[model samples]
Each structure stands twice: as structure tokens, then as C-alpha cells.
Target: MHRLAVGINYPAWAGRNYRIQTASTVVSGLGNAAAPIATAFAVLGAGWGTAEVGYVTAARTVPLVVLMLIGGAVADRWPRHVVMVSANVFNAVSQGVLAALVLMGHPPLWTLLALSAAGGAGQAFYAPAAEGVILRAVSAEHASKALSVFKMGMNGAQIAGAALGGLLAAVADPGWVLAGDAACFAVAALMRSGLTQVGGRRESGPSLVHELRVGWREFVSRRWLWAIVVQFSLMNACVLAVETVYGPVIAEDRMGGAGAWGTAMAALSVGMVASAVLMARWQPRRILLVGNGGVFLFGLPALALALGLPLIPVVVAMFLSGVGVTVFVVGWMVALRQEIPEELLSRISAYDAFGSFALLPAGTALAGPAADLLGRSGALWACALTCLGLAAAVLLVPEVRQLERKVPEARGNLPQPEPATSG
Candidate 1:
């Protein structure tokens, strides 16, 4: 009876952060499920051409690139929980607005685009604050484990969200699904309100631009960090182009329709969740090498599609790609947590986000025309070759191999000392 009680009441670990992590996972899962279905509905109901849909999706990147540094600085200067809650509120409003617009008979494309941009701006702020909270919540020794748990939660949420979104879309009006998404954001905001003050106090004196420059300097000094960013920038561009445009087009052509595309996407999410769970249990020693190596595995999906594999096999390939992506993402987060200073972590993270995602819009916008010229299968093969090349190039850098050893604090929840040298 005592043992049963202990199992129910006491977690295996100590820290409010773990509880916060769990809350985050729930919120993320609910929100993500709503987002994709809303997006799917917008595409199907609004009579938005492929190019217009791409444009709306791509426009979100603009704010991330432009205001992300400012958002990071705000996170550094304010209580991270406050920032997070506020951002969630903003996201909730945006989703609510989108739902209303859609229910009111599909508003103009420009209006939908504007709302997406507004939500993107909110997300730019939310991401850095969330990272700051994670950094502060757990002890240094537990950083890797904490990050692993966080990644697992996020991927799990995405998987659930995708599945839910698909199911919801199949049954009822998409506006209702979007409304539910807005509710999830509201709940997330409420949950964040319960968190303890995370950022201690605000820093004094420096202008936002000056702070941003300092962050840029810190970001550029790390060879492994920046190298991975560059590699992913290219990788994201390729993957987004294919997934957003070509993959759906192909699925529509071969497998019958959007439902099949949703299944493939859900498969990818499942793979990611599986990968994150594995990494959480078995933290890798050689972080950079392992991360990049896994990223290279994304090529399999592109190759499979290009080779005209059957639906089942193609789904398997997508799942494999998801696994690789999850590993790479968690590994990179672990590396970042180890390498960067907590004080500047948000700002640096913002820079990384901005730089890595900047090209996504261009990739999506160009994919249609490129597919037209090269053919869908041919374009996918090109993406596969490019990803493979980028992975190989990243492997050649000595810094990627050496940084793992240099980061001694990556294994457990111990408090980290001040960094002696910038990465």
C-alpha cells in the first residue's frame, strides 16, 4: 500500500520544472492538433490556389526573421513565464479570429494571411521565452534529460495533434476545429500563469539593438552551432518545399487525396515521438556527429518518393524521416543548452531560429515552379541529393566531433559553472 501510494504521489525526480514540462506537452499537443486542421480547411474551403496558400504560409517567416531578436531581448529582460503567457494569449486571439473569419464565409486571402503573420509574431516571442523557462527550470546536470523530455513531449503533442486534426477534419466543420485550437492556446496561457517567476529580474541599460548585436556575436562564435544552423537552413528549405507542395501533390495523385497526405504526416509525427522517446532514454555521447548523421537519414523519404514506391512504403519512408528529424532536433537542443550561457540563451536561440527559417518562404514559393520545370519526382530526388551532400559536408568539420567532449556538463541536473570560452 505504501509503495502504491509512493508511486502515485511521488515522481522519480525532483523539480517543479518536470511538472511544467508535462503541462507544456499537453498544451502543445492540443494546439498543434488544431493548427493543422485549420490550415487544411483553409486550403480546401477558401479556394486558395496553391501559390496563394504557399504565400500565406511563407509570410509568417517574415516576422520571425525581422522581430525575433527583439522578442528574445524581451524574454531576457522580463519574467519568462509572463512572456510565455502573453504570447499564448496573443496566439489564442489570432486563432479565434481565424475561426471567426472562416465561419463567416471564408474571408479574403489577405485577411487570413495577415492573421497568420500576427500569430507568427506572437510565436517569435513565445519560443525564446519557452526556451528560457526550460533553461532555468532544470539543474545543469539534468539539462540533457530535461531537453529530451521536452522534445518528447513536443513530438508527442504533434503526433496527437496531427491525428486529432485529421479525425476532426473528416467529421465536422474546420472552423470548430480551429475554435478548439484557440481554446488550447487559452489553456496554455492559463497554465503558464501558474509557473513561478523564472527570469529573476530584468537587465538594465543596453539598447535592444545593442543587445541583439551581442547575441549575434555569441551566435557566430560557435562553429558547430552555426554550422548546424546553416545545414538545417538548407535542409528545412528542401523539406518544407517538398512537404508543403510536392508531397501533398504526389499523395493526391497516387493515393487518392488529402486523407492520405494526413496519414503520411501523422506517420511522420509518430516516428518523431518514437525517436524522441529513444533519445530521452539513451542520451548520445557524441552529440554533433550523431545529430548530423541522423539528419542525413532524411534523404530516404525523398529517394523513396522519387523511386515511385507504393503508399505503404512511402509512408514508412516518411516515418523514417520523422525519426531522423526528431533525433537531430533533440541533439541540437542538448548541444545548445550545454554550449550557450543561460543569460544569453534566449537571444542566441532567437538568432538560430531566425537564420534557420529565413529561407523557408522562398523555398515554398519556388517549389511549385521548380516542380513544374523539373517534374515532382525529379525535384524530390534533387532534394534528396542536396540533403545528403549537406550532411557529408557538416561531417567534415572537426569542430563537430570535438565539441561533444568539450561540453562536459551535458549528461545530468547539476548546476553549470560559468563558461570559460564562448562556443
Candidate 2:
């Protein structure tokens, strides 16, 4: 494996699926940008407080945690591209309707809650299917590049989306942001239409429980995988919960509000974009260790927020943290694509999502109460420290610290990747 190939040029052979993925990513990025603003819009529009914010966040996420395995199973059993296209279609309709309602008048709490859950349902299927597609979309040798291209598209799109979302929220109506999200989803669906079907294997058993049992076997077999996932579970509970639900409220009260927060988010994306470029060329020797260590960066902004630091410091923290996020993501994908069996990939990924995300709602639900009990600043500090500690603790696992990348040899069971076609 020549490391130099990573940095020099885009692999022209990466194929039509890669092109479709990037195109779909553009719209997905746009929607990601708008989604947060839309949530902010809902909270502000309803004159809701911290608890409301947490609940709205949970409404979308809880379903993803619950349904992710089934989603993964669908991806593994059905044509991966079909699953992706369907999920995107669901997102378009759900957001489009929500936007219309928001445009007419202030939407009720129940409406926002329902719409968020609808969004979650789309994600439940889309996330794993989207990933599994890559296994067939590009070859094992090009895995890093394929993922880099995909992630690069996402970050670049999100940056533009976040900027636009903030502007729409502040200058215009957030309903427009929601409308924009619907349009993005529509475009993503169209882009995904071109993707070839992948994941030909059907579960050997008919029962859903049997399918889950097989998936769980793959998930737990890799100690390193589960170890890192456990760390993220805790991190999401503490760091993510505080950052998503509580941090925004703090920004509104202390900083310049939505616009300021948007800029901060963009700073994060900027870092992510830079890291993606670097990752395209660079493969680490100890990927799991690197990934595990990179999570410390997430604590930076949280600590800054807790301390009531200036906006610039928080923005900088977010920016640096974004780089860490990109590292972990790329490394995780590389490790999984190289190490896991294709027949089991989607289901394993789903299980990973399930464990990693299972506690998110609990964390979100707890964040507000934790704040009430500990004070906002105190809760933020606690969450930040807790996550930082977990990040470090994961490194103590020998499997994670020592796992090295293996150049893949021809393996049985999984179908071979087709020659990467020109776009």
C-alpha cells in the first residue's frame, strides 16, 4: 500500500456510485445545516425552554437508536441503494410538510415533536444503508479515498448549509430553512437513484430476532470495535447532550444568539473540511488508538462554554474539535471496512449505532435536569470532564491501542468489489 497515492490525486476509477454519493451528500449536507436551525426555530417559536429543547432533540434521536438495527437489517437484505433512496424520499416529504405548516403559522408543540420523529425514522434506515453501499461502490483498496470523498462532500455541504440556515433563521423565517431542507432531501433522493444495488445476502433465518442475534455476534466479536463504541456512548451522553441541548440555550442568552452559534458550528465544519483533505492521503498505523485519542478535542468547546468564555474561544474550540471528529470517523470507517465481513457489515454497523446511540435520549433528558441541579455552567463543566475522561479511558484497552491496519487479502463469503467505474 503506497501512502503517497492517498495525497496525490483523486482516483478517477472511483466510479458512478461515488459520484452519486457525492451528489446525494450535497443535499444531505444542506439538510443537516438546516435541521439544527429548524430545531432552534421550533424552540424559539414555541417559546419553549431548556426541557423543551432536550425533548425535541430526543424525539428525533430516540427513534434512530431504537430502529437502527432493523434499518441495518433492511440494508443488508434489500438493495442498499433502494433503502437509501426510500429514506431520502421519506425525509423530503416529512420536511416539506413540516415546512408548509411552519410557514402558515406557529406550529404546535405536538407538530414539531411529530415532525422530528419523522426525520428520525428516515435516518434510521438511511445511515447504515448509506455506509454499506460503499463496500460495493468502491474497492477495498480505495476505501479511504471513497470515504474521504463522501465525508468531504458532507462537510463542504454542511458549511454552506449552516451559513445559509443561520441567515434564513435570523433574517427570514426558519420555515424557509425547513423548506430548504425538504428540497435538499428531494435532490439527495434523485442522486441516490443512480446508485447500484449492493448487499445481496439475505439473513439465513426468517425471524427478526435471529437476524439481530447474528449481527450481535459480529459486533461483540471485535473487542476493539465495541470498546470504542462504549466510549462514544458515554461521550454522547455527556458531551453531546450538553453541547446539543444546553449549549445553544446558553449561546442565546450569553452570546449573540442563532447567528453566533451558526458561525461557531461553521468553524467546526471548516476544521472537518481540512481534516478530510488530510485523511484522503494519510492512513494511520494505529487507527483505533488515533481515533480514541482524537475525542479529547470534543471537550475543548464544552469546557470553554462552561467557563463562559468569549465566542471566539468557543468557536476555535469547535474548529479544532471538528478535526478530531473527522479523524475518528475516517479511521472508524477504514477499520470497519477492512476488518468486518460484508454480509455482516450493515448489521454490525447497525448494532454499533444502537449501542453508541442508545443512551442519547437519556443524556438529553438528563442534561436539563442536571443543569437545574448543578447549574448550567456546572453541568457543562461536568459533562465536558466526564467525556474527556472516557476518551482517555478507552485507550487503556490493549486491543484498541495495538490494532494495526491489514492490507486486505482475498476473503471468502463476501463478493469481490467490481472495478471502480468512471463517473
Candidate 3:
């Protein structure tokens, strides 16, 4: 009876955080599902080839990267919940239009790509605000546990969403799947309707440039932070680049198409679920070093794809790679929160987000062409080798290799400007 009650006790479990946490997980999970299907819709239905798929995806990433700084600044300046709600609404509208077109008939490649760019713009604004909102929802002491749970929900959603996306694309229609995704964003926004504003307070700064400069200074001051960012940037550019752009297109030709790729994606999400559950309960020392080291495994899935391995073996590689991504997610968030002041958290997070995905657009742009020129296997070999080697090289940096988290005495002291009261 006691365990059952605890399981069902939404009120006392995590206080005001329950609502926002649920919403965030939905947002992340649905967003993940939508992105890949959106790509497939452009490729399979709209008749975009691999190169066009890469370019269309890059169209979304370009605006996201360009506008992240402004988004972070806005997040720090306003109520995070409000910012998030606005962003989700934009996402709903953008995707809703795309879904409508896809349902009507195959939209032109340009139209699909343009709408994708709109969604990316919304993502730019949402990412920092959502991070800030979730960060403040839970008590500081339970940060890792809360984030882990949040990630677990996202992974769970990914399992369902990715598989569903593939199944729909294979059987029904990707447009129908996209429509569901838009509805999810709407539902997510509704869920966040009551989340108390936690971002009203802002550090006293003269101007946006001044604030950004401050964020930049704070970012560079932490050698460990910058080192990890540098590591991920290279990894994304060289290896993840190949995986994201090339993997799907190749699967369409070599494997069974969207459904097989989706199953593989679901397998990856299953691995992430394991990672989230473990990280939620265990906060490790030297997380930065340990996490970064684990990323060496992340390149394996693409390597398997490159090697022309069987589906089962490729799925296994993806599973390990998923685990590696979660390790980085946990380590990076916890370490950054522990080290950086709350007021500047969003901005700093933005910088990290920018850096982590900094080269993604460039990589996406080049990946298709590179694969065409070098052969998919040759490109895969180059990417896999470069990522694994560079990630290992980051350990040579003393700051990243030796960093440890020291818990703050008052961890949950960040402002909730609206003084929220749980009913």
C-alpha cells in the first residue's frame, strides 16, 4: 500500500515540478520523432535524394544555430514558462502547416524545407527557456534524479515515436504522423499552462551584447566546460555528421526502408532508457571525464553502418551509442549547473548548445556530397576514425580529464520569481 501510494502521489512527490517535467518530456520526445519523419517525408514522399535531404535538414539547423544567442538572452530576461509556451505554439503552427500539406499531397521539396526552417527557429527559442524552466522546477539536491527522470520520459517517448514514425511512413502516411506530432506540441503547451514563472529575475547588465560578453567570459573561464564543448564539436562535425545525414538515406536503399531504420532508432532509445534510469539513481564523481570517455562508443553505430553489417549488429551498435549520448547528457548538465550561477545558466547553456551543435549544419551540408564522392563506406570510415580518435584526444586535457562536481550547500536557491504555491 505504501509503495503504491508513493507511486501515485503526484502531489507530494516532486512538488510543482511534476507538471513541467511531464510537459518537457513530451516536448522532447515528440520533437525527436517529428524531426526524423519530417526528413523522411521530404526524401521518400517529396522525392528528395540524399543530398537534398541533407540540405533541407541543414536549412532548419542554420536558423537554430544563428538565433540561439538571442533565444538564450530572451530566456534569461523573461519568465521561462511563458517563453516555452510561446515557442511550442509556434512549433505547433509550423508543423501543423507542414502536416496539412503532406496530407494534401506531397508538398514540393522547397516548401517542406521552408517549414522545417520555421520549426528550427521555434526550437532555437524553446531550447534555452525549456532548460531554464526545468532546471528550477526541482529542488537542487534532486537535480540529477529529476533530469534523469525527464530524460527517461524522453527516451520512452522516443521508443514509441520513432517506431511509430517509421511504421506510419512505411504503411499509412508520414503526413498523419506529422499531424500527431503537431498535436503533441499543442498538448505539451497546454500542460505547461500552469507552470509557475521561474525566470523573471535577470542579472543587471547594460545591453544584450554586454550580457553575451558576460556569458562568453563565464564560458571560457571554465576550462573543463570549454574542453568538453570542443570535444563534442569535433565529434559532431566528423562522425555524428555522417550518422545523421547519411544513415537514413542509405537505410532506405540497402535496408528495408523507414520501418527498419525506425526499429533501429527505437533500439537506440531503449539503450538510452537504461542509461537514464542508471544516471538518475547514481551521481558519479569525475562525471565529466567518465562521460566524455564513454562517447568514444557513440561513433560505433555509424561505423557498423559503414561496415555493411547485418541489421541486428547495426542495431546493437546504435544501442551502445545511445547509452553513450545519455552519459554525456547527464555529465554535461550536472557539471554545468554545479559550476555556473543560476542567473547565467540559460545563456551559458545556450553557448554550450551552440558549440555542441555548432558544426552540425556544416557537417550536414557536406555529408551527402562527401558520401557520394568517397562512397558511403569510405565516408563512414573517415568519420568514424576521426570522431573516435579526437574524442580520445580530449582526455589529454587536464581540466576535462580531472574535473569533479562539488555539490552546493544551497542548491535549489535559484529564484522562482512568481513565488509558486502548489495546491
Q: Which candidate has the highest lDDT of all?
A: 2
How well is each residue in 251-352 modelled by candidate 1, as lDDT tens digits? 656775556666777788778878877876666688878877788778877888889887788789889998998778777877777778888989988888
Error of 2 at 248 (Å): 1.8
| Local distance difference test scores for all models | 0.75, 0.80, 0.77
lDDT of 3 by residue, 76-166 (tens): 8888788888988898898889889888887888898799889889989889887776666655566677677777888889888888888
- Could you give candidate 2's per-residue lDDT for residues 74-164 as a string of tens digits? 8888788889889999999998988888888778878888998899889999988888877657667666766876788889888888877
- Model 1 segments more than 4 A misplaced: 1-14, 201-203, 405-423
Ranking by TM-score: 2, 3, 1
Q: What is the lDDT of candidate 3?
A: 0.77
For each candidate in turn, give its C-alpha RMSD to the true structure in angstroms.
6.1, 6.0, 4.7
| Superior by lDDT: candidate 1 or candidate 2 | 2
TM-score of 2: 0.91
TM-score of each: 0.89, 0.91, 0.91
